[model samples]
Target: MARGCDGSEAGARLRGIYRTKQSPIFLPDFLRSRIHVSVCALICVVGGWPSGTEERVIQPVSNEEIISLALDEIDGERRAEVAGRIAASPDASRTLAAVTIAVQTMRADDSISPPGEVVQRVLGLMRSGVRVRTSLMDVAGQVAEQVREFLCTLVRDTQSEPALAGFRGTTESRHLSFECEIAEIDVQVSRGEGEARRTIRGQVASLTDDTVGRIAWRSTLTGAAEREIAADESGVFVLECPVGVYELSARVGGSVVRIPPISVA
Candidate 1:
C-alpha cells in the first residue's frame, strides 16, 4: 500500500479545496481547526464586521414614547437612544413625523377659554386633592331645575338690512344673528344640494360661560317633520330641510333658547 500523506500535506490540500470550491467538505481534526480560522478571517473581511466592534441592537419604540419625544418630555441619553432606534425603524419614524405635525397644527389652532370660576374650581380641587363625583341622576336633576325657556330676538338679519336691500340680488345664502339672555346664535342659511332645499349652519356661544359640551337642538319646518341634532363640542350645528319657514331651538346648559320662524327661500 502507498504511504498515507502527512498531516501538513493533507491540511494544505483541504484548505485549497475549501478556497476553490467554497462548499462544505469533510476534514480531519487538525484541518478543521485551520479551516475554521481561515473561514472566520474571510467572514470578517467579506461581511463588513470590523474588528473589536459590537453589533448594534435595535429596539421598537411605542406610540406613547414617540408622542413624549415630540412633546420634548424625554431628555438625556435615553432620548438619544430612543431617537436612534426610531430612525432605524421606518414605521416608527413615520408615526413620529405624523405626531409632530399634528402637535404643531394644534398649537397653531385657536383654543377655547373656560370660565374663570371653572378654572378656579379646578385649581382648588387639584390643591385639595379632592375628587368630586356626581351621579348621573343628580346631575340630570340639577340641569332640569335650572332649565328655563327664552325666546331669542333677532339682533341682525342681512336680508332685512335697508342698506343691503338695494344691493341684495338673488343670492343663495343669508346670514342671521339672534341673541337671548343666556347665549348668542349666528346662523348661515344656504341653498342645499337638492332643489327647493335649504341648509342651516349655526354656532351657539354661551353668554355666561364657554359652551362646555354638545347641546341638543331641533328645527321644525312648518307642516313638516322635525329634525333634531346635537351641536358639536364647539357648539356648531347643521340642518337640512325643505324650503319653508322654520322655528329653531337649542337646549343649552339649563336654558331652552328658541328662535322665531324664519323663511328660507
Candidate 2:
C-alpha cells in the first residue's frame, strides 16, 4: 500500500495541480504523484506563465484606428508608437493599404457639373426670396383632388408682393396671403419685445361656405408637434412663438390644408 502523508509544501503544490479528489480515477497513483514535478519542469523550460505588473506584449489594433492612421489624423509620438505596432502586424498593414488605395481612387475620379439652365433656375428661386415647401398630405392621396382645384385658385390668389418684404421700420410686421378651394388664409408675423418673443396673427375664412374650423402652427426648425390655436367667431386667431421657420395647417370642415414652410427671419 502507498504511504499516507501529512500536509507539506510538496503535497500542497500537488493538491493545487490536481484540484479534485477524483483526479485519481483518471490517472494511476504513480502518474498522479508526478503532476507537480511535470508542471514545474514545463514552467522552467518556458520561462514561466505570462503574468505580473508588466505592459501587455500583444495589443489589438481596431479597423477605425487603422483608417485614422491611413488618413494622417494622428501625429507626433503617439502616431509613431501606433505606426510601429501596425508595421509589426501583417493584418493591420494590409487594412491600411486597402483604405489608402480606396481614398486615392476616389480623389482620381472626375467631378460632376450641373447644367447651366438648371443652375440658373435654382439661383432665381433663391433670389426671389420665396421659399416654397411642399405639403406632406398633398403628396399622399389625401389631398390629390383638392390640390388641382387649389392650384387653379392659386393663380387668382397671387397678390401684390412677398410678405417677407412688407414689414416697415420698428414694428417689423409681414403679411402672407394664400388662397385655396377651401379657404383664403392671411397671416401677419411680427417680433415682440421682452417676454412676448414673436407673434403670428392670422385669419382663416371659407372660400366656398360658412363652415369654420381650427388652425394650428408647427415649428419646422424645432420639429415639435402642431399646437392648436382657437379662433374667434370672426375666424381670427393669434399664435406666439420663437424666431424660426414654421408650417401652418388649417382644418375647415372635412378638408385639411397645410401651408409651406415660412421663415421667421
Candidate 3:
C-alpha cells in the first residue's frame, strides 16, 4: 500500500485511500475478521513503540507502517534521522505519517529546528501534489489563530515619523504584551584577501547585559562584499558586516541602540 524511503523503494504518491469515491465494497464481519485482525495488529505494532514491546525488525509492510515503526524509537535523535530519511521519499511525504515524525521528533527536543518553518516548507512542497495530512491540520490551526500578528509585523511602513513606522510597538502574545522594534538594514560587506580575508561581526545587547543577540548578516555588496547569514533563532542575531563605515543598530525591549560605525579597511 505505502512504504518508507529506506529498505523499500519509494512508490507512487498516494492520493490516499478512496473508499466511496472509487466505489468501495462492503464486507461482512465474519468474512473479513482474519484480514481485519491482521491490519489491527500491524497498526498496533507500528503506532505503539518504545513503551510497547513485542517489536521485531522486519520489512515495512506499508508506507504508514514503517513510518510508525521508525517513529517508535525511544531516542529522538535516532527517530529524527530515520524520519528524515523516510520524508525524503515522495511515497512517504504524501501522508500525514511524515508530519508526525517531524513534529514528534521536534516535540521531544525543542532544540531541534526541523519542527518549525522547515516543516512548513516540506508540507508546502508535498501538498503541491498530495492530499493534506490530517496530523498537520492542528498545527496549522493553532498557527492561524494569530496570523494577523505576523502579517502586520512582516509588513511595515518605514517612511513615517519614528513613532509611525509601525515597526515600534507592543504585541500581545499569550498573556503578556511585549515591546517590539523591527528594522531593515543594509548588509555588511567584507574585504581583504587570501588568509587575510577581512570579516565583521555585529551583536545586540540588553542594557542590563543579560541577553546578547547576534544579527543575521545579509546584504548586497557594492564596493566590498557581504556575507549571507542564517540562524535558527532570529529573535536576536549577530551579523557579519564587510568593510566600510556604516550605520548599525538593533532594538532591545522598547529601545534602539545605534553602534558607532567601524571600518575594516
- CA shift at 187, candidate 1, in angstroms? 1.2
lDDT of each: 0.62, 0.60, 0.34
The TM-scores, one per candidate, come to: 0.41, 0.39, 0.20
lDDT digits (tens) for residues 1-265 of candidate 1: 1111333423333343443222346456677787656655554455433445232223346676688889889999768866886898899899999999999999998988998865664444332211111121133465654556666899999877754555557675789999988888888899897998888898887787635343333223223333455677777888787775566656566556667667678
Which candidate, 1 or 3, has the higher TM-score?
Answer: 1
Off by over 4 Å in 3: 1-197, 209-241
Better of 1 and 3 by lDDT: 1
* Clash count per candidate: 0, 0, 13
Model 3, 150-187: lDDT tens digits are 00011222222254356455421111011223332322
Output the number of the lDDT-best candidate. Answer: 1
Q: Global lDDT for candidate 2? A: 0.60
